[model samples]
Target: MVAPPDNDVLWARGLHHAHGGTSALAGVSVGVREGEILAVTGPRGSGKTTLLKCLSGQLVPSEGEVWFNSAPVHTLSSPSRERLRLDRFGWIDTEPHLVPELTAWENAALPLLLRGTGTRSAKHTAVEWLDRLDVGMCANRRPARLDQSQRQRIAIARALATTPQVLFADEPTAPLHRSDGTQVLRTLTTAARSHQITVVLATHDPEVATLADRSLALLDGRQSGAAAEAAGSSDEESRAACSLSV
Candidate 1:
């Protein structure tokens, strides 16, 4: 396979995947540049999550090539892929998925601690991210003690504390109320911009996609035309709003 473009931090071409003989992605190709926020938008079951999973090395495509920093990700062994994710990628799921036994700070610092960071350093970093997400007051509380919105914020803090090279967020605000989701999403995109972390955000909401630098729309497991027109728009002012909003 040919090497990916030098400017692309993550790139995939002709991707195809199936789940138990059922098609999920069909010849989908995408590229994300460093520090760029790319939203994968579509209806439910439109292959957004599958695409994200493939690009993030969580799933191997049945047919295609995935590259990160010009290195072939599709060819990496399972253990190597796990290592790469631990070292370079952060992920936030739709649910909070916080550790029930640990306090919010401890939960947020889990990744850093797993990476062998000092306890003090991990807590410091986690707390800083908590404060940024307006969930610092909940740092000492366990997941059960926090509200749904608060728990989601802690989850986001956990993802950001590592300052990962790339972050994969799959419907990160799905568990929150509309107002809460909007605020949390704003904070997320803003933090990503400030940290220069490339973000691949999967969402079914068009308004949510607007916060991204570009959007890729999928339909029935294939790329659609709607997003193609808007993908290259790159509204600088719109993206700049993230910095100003938070």
Candidate 2:
């Protein structure tokens, strides 16, 4: 694969968003490196989902810029942006949102099928991801047959089946128990690292943030104090002093 011109595969600058005149994001800027996991963390309404949507083109920002590789996402036509998302990006929302009637593997294959992969090949890839996520036995079950955690794993499998260039996960484990969440996250991060997939993870969990190569904290849609900055600093003292301990 050809190397990108810069380390950051995704970039956003001075992002601002408002829904019904209430600001969700305000002047948020961030850069995510290629093949690295970045955690976006905060309390509810901190604009975690909004930031992810804007960066991934799910929601166009009211103002600011988002760039994918060398392409300006904000300036692209709607169709172009849609194609970009379908072809190069993957998204895992807090909810699984699986098709109730579709089997697990079928639901996982949705992206591949949408992208025109042959049925057999799509199923193969989907099953592989589900197996990797430890949901192999659930592959034939429809959403209604499985519990919330199982459904979420299927959703994760669907996102990974495409081997997308970038993966955006917003509170992916919010629906599971601590043990289940830990296992699922371990599986997700391992698979992502093995594939060298860049990840933008949004969560309020400190344990989850420690899994990332770097993290950013948001408060009321804007980046907060220098805590995250200090964590990533090259200074030995800062590294030694980081509270996350990872």
Best by TM-score: 1
Worst 10 residues of 2 by lDDT: 237-246
lDDT (tens digit, per residue) of candidate 1 on 126-171:
9999999999998999999899999999999999999999999999
Q: How does model 1 fare in lDDT?
A: 0.91
Q: Report the number of clashing residue pairs per model.
A: 0, 0
C-alpha lDDT of all candidate models, in order: 0.91, 0.86
- Model 1, C-alpha of 246: deviation from truth (Å): 5.7
Candidate 2 lDDT over 23-59, as tens digits, reads 9999998888777778899999999999999999988
In candidate 2, position 171 carries an lDDT of 97
Clashing pairs in 1: none
Which portions of model 1 show Cα errors greater than 4 Å?
226-235, 244-246
In model 2, how large is the Cα lDDT of residue 157?
94
Q: What is the TM-score of each candidate against the true structure?
A: 0.96, 0.90
Best by lDDT: 1
